[model samples]
Target: MIQLHDKIFKPFISSGELDETVSNMVQEVTKDLAGEIPVFVAILNGSFMFASDFLKKYPSNCEISFLKLASYEGTSSTLKVKQLVGLNTSLKNRTVVVLEDIVDTGNTIVEIADLLANEGAKDIKIASLFYKPEVYSKDLTIDYIGMSIPNKFIVGYGLDYDELGRNLPEVYQFYKQTDK
Candidate 1:
């Protein structure tokens, strides 16, 4: 268990589980990207940890870049996305792969995809470490999903709360334990 702010969260996803899932997903990604060299655009901050694992395991020849986007303030999404930094690489006529830590409301992903498309990316693929399908409201499809979780606030494995808990090796979720 871990504490972030006033909340206590219990272990949700373990480190071993993360390694196994990422290993399996790498095979699928390699097969899907057999003939092309894709450019991986990793969303910054929260995605740094996931991207470190995923990109290391992704066998396909690819280039990597980063874009920083912010939307969440604490456990809730502000629903208003902002770009803290911009993309420097030219995505023209290239296959682009976007790696995200989590996809919730999908506002940020949609916005990034639009910009990439407008810059002439030939194809775009989205990969997310975690997905909350119940609360996902965007039309874009997540091409690679590590896991589907309930609509609960979680932290760890690069995910943070008010800039804490990102260093944890496993995921932690809000626990509703009570003592009488």
Candidate 2:
């Protein structure tokens, strides 16, 4: 168990399960991309682990890049995205894949997609490790998803609370405030 924001979160998804899910998702994405060599754009600060794992399972050729965006004020999102680190590569006419740790409100994904489009990316797709359907508000399509989870505060596998607990190998959920 781990503590965050005065809450205790028990382990939910184990490291093995995360690996399998990411592997399957990567395989699917590779099949979809087929002959095109897509650019894997990892959303930084949260997707480092997921992106690395996913890339290892990818059986196709691709390039990798990083972009940093911020939206969370704490456990809850502020629903506003701030571009902290911009994209350095030219996305014009390139096939771009945005890798994310989680998609809750979808605001961050939408903002990133729009930016990529404006920069002339020929195609844009999202590959997320987790999806919270209940709170997801954006109508934009998510091209690929690893898992759908219930509404809860989650950490680990690169997810964090106040910039902590990201080093855990498995995913955990905060069930009570006292645990933290």
Candidate 3:
């Protein structure tokens, strides 16, 4: 159990499990894009940790860039995605893979894919460490997914609550006490 700000959280996923999931995702990507020399665009702040682990285990040549987007104020999404930092690299005619920490309602990633497509990216792939299928409403397909989780507020392994709990080795979901 852990507390961040005014919320209590309970253990949801272990660090070992997460590592295995990431490794598997990387392996799958390598198999499909070994010699493609894809460009990996990591969504910043929240994706820092996942990007680090992902790039380290990726056994191929790839270009990397960061794009920071914000859609959450606290534990919930504001539903308005804002690009805090823009991508300087040219994605034109490139196979771009988007690295995200988590995909919930999918608004942010959808917007990113659309922008990359508009910029002339030959192909765009979405890879996320965590996914909330229950709440994901977008039509975009996630190329590689680490885990499919329920609609729960989780933090840790790059996810956070008001900028807290991102350093936690494992993942935790918000805990609500039942009044008995």
State the C-alpha lDDT per candidate: 0.89, 0.91, 0.93
Question: lDDT tens string, model 2, 1-180?
Answer: 877767788989999999999988888998889999999999999999999988887888899989999999778898789999988888889999999999999999999999999999999999999999998988899989899999898999999988888999999998777822
lDDT per residue (tens digit) for residues 150-179 in model 3: 999999988899999989989999897434
> lDDT-based ranking, best first?
3, 2, 1
Model 3: per-residue Cα lDDT at residue 62: 96
Per-residue error for 157 in candidate 3, Å, reads 0.8
Write out the backbone clash pairs for model 2.
Answer: 6-177, 7-177, 7-179, 7-180, 8-179, 8-180
What are the RMSD figures for all models against the true structure? 2.2, 1.3, 2.0
RMSD of candidate 2 to the true fold?
A: 1.3
lDDT of 2 at 27: 82
Question: What TM-score would candidate 1 get against the native?
Answer: 0.95
Worst 10 residues of 3 by lDDT: 171-180
In candidate 2, stretches whose alpha carbon ends up further than 4 angstroms from where it belongs are: none
- Cα TM-score per model: 0.95, 0.96, 0.96
